[model samples]
Target: MVSPMLSMNQATIKHADLRQTLDTLTQTGYHSVGLWREPVEAIGVPEAVRMVSDSGLCVSSMCRGGFFTMPEGPERRAAIDDNRRLIEETSAFGCTVLVLVVGGLPQGSKDLAEARSRVAEALAELEADALAAGVTLAIEPLHPMYCTDRACVSTLDEALDIAAPFNPKAVGVVVDTFHVFWDPNVLRSIARAGREGRIAAYQVCDYRTPLEADPLLSRHYPGEGVIDFKALTQAVAATGWHGDIECEIFNRAVWDTPFDEVSRHVADAFDKYVAPYWPAE
Candidate 1:
């Protein structure tokens, strides 16, 4: 059974030092954290690993990998090699999954379908490396608004379709409420993921305000938003998913605040807005 835990994704506390964030999170009773490569590399991977270990914090997942849609050439090959390094780092930190954000359209290219295919090819190459490392590679389907620049895998179904070739190993989908709550087929997708053993992670957050055409700006705390979180949780629970339910909010307003306060707010919001739905059954 996967114990319910929290990870301090870089989204919440942007300006604070990574070590300080980990320390504070540990002090606050969060047993796990998400390590961002940018900050981790800055601090040195070995030292970063040691710091997390010394603090007794488990890393739930590494920040990112798999942006193959850019220059499908030498640049893309370099990304694959870099992802191998990320897998090694995740292993060192005792993380369960290496999160992947499949890239979007290339510069001046409106060919989204081609970008999606590029991601599929890249994942096929990375799948073996990830499985060999005993680490799952979780493809997070970003909100549709980010389709142009973030991730072409913009839905759970799409991700599962791409992950079809890597079953029973570690290629899977990440269900983030903010990205998927509005999806017409979310319930079926979650159940399908469960059936296929492809739920690498499930993230819970809400979209409070009515969405603008821009999907990036549409995110809210679990209950404060319009997401039918009850239905979402019911679907996830139905699949017997005991994995970490991450709270990944990328709100600009939240990131600009104090770290301590954001943690408190996020934790409180989890309890008040998100946790009630995931009752232990």
Candidate 2:
């Protein structure tokens, strides 16, 4: 079997410095890393690019550039402009995919359909710029739990529908195990995304029980929780996806561990639970 390239998402080691994270990833044999926009921006895009490039590691994807559900006003316009800048940054880093966590309802509003509609409109507005920048806008469907605040796009199918009107090269879907594993139709959605050629990124992380108060940080490493990594990995492989499988956990416990040790654990988990499902050579 030919294992997919493994990538470490910056969120996995949120407490570590970007340079230290990159260094640890390289030392642990990760071929690439997924960067978070906040940290990358904190270091300045050019320097962040230089740091990763100097480490000889490729960027798998940039963690987010979407939040268009706000009320139309300066805030909304600013969000779009910020996303455009994020697209440029992704291009500057030579990364092809920029993950988008399309925002949920505007404050004091509960109309999900409206929020979803706004997301579609936002994608249309950014599609041309995404193409121009050579960056694919990867719509990440966060778990239903995040539907009220983080992302209204809560399933791969919903994300695909949002990307349907645009060229796959300009818009695609992110298949994140931690978020989509609970979906009854996820397997079908994966197949559909593959057939449509809109699977831009595949992120792997387990879902823990007794969810954290801030569920956003509830992600666990592969095989550490209830996620059936074997099944999910096989499903992704069945789609003929050959992209990097990023390990992006947000657990505070994992973050507290030493970055080097965390890197080793991530590599071992990928080899154990994920690599076995790789398509045969």
Give the candidate number with the greatest lDDT: 2
Cα lDDT of model 2 by residue, 47-108, tens digit: 98888889988999998889999878999999999999999999998999999989988999
**Lowest lDDT block of 10, candidate 2:** 1-10
Global local distance difference test of model 2: 0.89
Best by TM-score: 2
TM-scores for every candidate against the unseen true structure: 0.92, 0.97
lDDT for each residue of candidate 1 in 187-264, tens digit (9 for 90 to 100): 999999999999888777777666645556456555677888778887988898776667776676776777777777
Candidate 1 segments exceeding 4 Å error: 1-4, 210-218
Candidate 1, residue 183: the lDDT equals: 87
Clashes of each: 2, 0
Model 1 residue-pair collision total: 2
TM-score (C-alpha, index-matched) for candidate 1: 0.92
Scored by CA lDDT, what does every candidate get? 0.78, 0.89
